[model samples]
Target: MPRALVIEDDHKIAELIKIHLKDLHYEIDHTLDGLEGYEMAKKTNYCLIILDLMLPSMDGMEVCRKIRANDIASPIIMVTAKSEEIDRVLGLETGADDYIVKPFGVREFQARVKAVLRRSLGKFENQSSTNNQIIEADGLSIDLDKRSVQKEGIRIELTPKEFDLLSLLAASPGKSFNRQSLLNLVWGYDFEGYEHTVNSHINRVRAKIENDMNKPSYILTSWGYGYRFNENI
Candidate 1:
């Protein structure tokens, strides 16, 4: 069974998440205090972390920053009651692999967790078998073997999901992929309305690898179709 960490302060919410996660066959550890949760997370190798935005001892953002700073590569799903789009985007930009709003149904919650884990598992299985081919376009370089990306000789730090999205698109240059296809291929989720997640990741990736966000050199919008890599690059 894969280990999971749930850092939620609300007993009711935490218990609800615990029950569903247990049903999924995960061995979970829970904590009400953010600082305590961080300590527990550091002590264990967890496959996934369900983190709440509000907690005692430390806030969710700080916990996320600390965990990433510690180099823990576990996927994080940030739960928040704030429904603002900015809040959700901030969580994603904060190194979290996914996010869920409070008041979500058990099915949606479980599905999100499963999707994240499935994506991680696929990446792990492909780490060795992924043809060790290097992709170079303009000033950008992607080392599939090292799972590293660089632009203009400077290494760029990308979240695992961002890198996966970039690799998938780059692997098939000039192929226009709709958001649903990208989500299914990169996130292991086929749900509707989450296409914006792909858009956000694409924008972020372009920001990192492209010199001008307004006029991207590599990633190009397919207009009616979705997105595709610049074939001319």
Candidate 2:
């Protein structure tokens, strides 16, 4: 059975999530402390992680950061009562694959979980089906199956979302993907006005892969439209 970790402080909320996840046939591990959740995540390979923004010992942002810093690529769904726009954006920026606001309908919550898991599974299938998995340009190498990147022969770590974003652009060289398009394609959700979230992820990827962020050579701006992988690289 596939397992999931739920790091939530509220008993009611955690119970709600646990019940639904069990319905999806997942083995669940529940914790009220962020530190314990982080430790469990580090030691186990869960198919999904349901993380709350507020918890004892550590905040969700720090926990998410630490998990991603360790290159644990499990899909994460950040659950929180805070529905502010900034909170949602920060959750994504911190490496959560998806986010849900509190007091949410059971249907919406379940839908988000299902969508994230579907996308995660799709990535694995797509990777395994392709024999030609590496895309190279200007000394940057992206291994599609392995989900790894090396810039100028030096391995660079990227969050799972970052890797997905980069892979999409690199595979379609010179195709200018507007922010909304990227948001839909990479995130599996159409967040209408949250284009800046895409911009933030792009900036982080550029910072890691570019020799100079000011003069980026791989990812180029499309002036009035969006971003594209440099075809002439």
Candidate 3:
């Protein structure tokens, strides 16, 4: 069974989420304190993590950043009462794969969890189609089998999402992929209104790989189309 961690301070909310996750056949762990939750997350492995933005001892954003800084790639779903667009974008930038506003329905929550897991599986499926070889372009080397990247002979560390997004673009050099298409392929959902998520991932990937974000060599803007990898590279 898949495992999940729910770090929600509200007793009722946490239990509700736990019950629903259990219904989906997930082994769930719950924590009410942010510090404790962070400790538990660091100590254990989970397929997914559902975290509330507001909590005691620490904030959800910091927790997400800490996990990512530790190189943990498990998908995170951030829950927040604030429905501001800035909050959503900030959560994603901090490394949460998805976010849920407060008062969400059970079905919506379930769908989000399933969608994230599906995206993870889709990544595996995409990798399986490749021959497990390294792709080289303009001094950049990406080992598909190892999931490692090196720029100009220097190893570059990237988040799992960053690497996946770059891999998709680089694998099909010169092919333009619109934001929606990239979101569907990379995020495993076409629910709409999440193209900015794709843009954020692309920008982060470029920061890691490009000598100049202003003049990226690997990934290129397709103007009105969307984004494409540099075929010339």
Candidate 4:
């Protein structure tokens, strides 16, 4: 069973999540304080973390930053009452894999959790495989086995999700994948309704791969259709 750590101060919300996750056969551990949550995350090998932005001892953003700084790569899903776009972006920038606002449906919440866990486990499997997958396009080279990307002979540091997004687009250059499609492909089948996650990750990827994110060359937008990779580049 996959282990999950939930850092939520709300008793009702935390209990709801624990019950649902237990139904899905996940080993659940939870805390009502951010500091304790962060400590537990560092000491354990959890498959995923459900973290709330508001906490008694420490804020979730600080916990997230500390976890990333410590090289903890487990997937983190931020649960926040704050629905502001900037708040969501900040969570992602702080190394959160995904985020969901409050007043969310239970089904959607469960789906997001499953999706994150699946993606995390899938990455582990991919890393174990001996796949000769080095995608080169427009002065960018991505090595799947090594899990690294180089642009114009210079290595770029990318988050795990950023790397996945780039690889998906690079693998099918010129193919436009809608936000939902990309989410399902890169995130997992269980991911639902948060297309913004795709948009944010794409922007981050472009920042690393393109000289200017505003005028991206490798990953082009298909307007209403979605986003496509520049195969000719």
Candidate 3 residue runs with Cα over 4 Å from true position? 123-160, 178-181, 188-196, 207-216, 222-226
Order of candidate numbers by TM-score, starting with the best: 2, 3, 1, 4
- Where in model 2 is the C-alpha error above 4 Å? 123-133, 150-157
- Stretches off by above 4 angstroms in model 4 are 82-84, 121-159, 169-233
Model 2, backbone clash pairs (residues 3+ apart or across chains), number: 0
Q: How would you encode candidate 2's per-residue C-alpha lDDT over 40-113 as one tens digit per residue?
A: 99999988999999889999999998898787889999987664667778888778899998888778988999
lDDT of 4 by residue, 45-138 (tens): 8878999988888999999888877767778999877556566667876778888888777798888887765564344333335354787887
Q: Residues 189-223, candidate 3: write the lDDT tens digits.
A: 56377677777778878877888999998999999
Name the candidate that leads on lDDT: 2
Model 1 segments beyond 4 Å from truth?
A: 1-6, 11-48, 54-74, 79-95, 99-118, 121-132
In model 3, the clashing pairs are none
Order by lDDT, highest first: 2, 3, 1, 4
Model 1 Cα shift for residue 81 (angstroms): 8.6
The TM-score between candidate 2 and the true structure equals: 0.84
List CA RMSD, all candidates: 5.1, 3.0, 3.6, 5.6
Q: Which ten-residue region of model 3 has the weakest summed lDDT?
A: 118-127
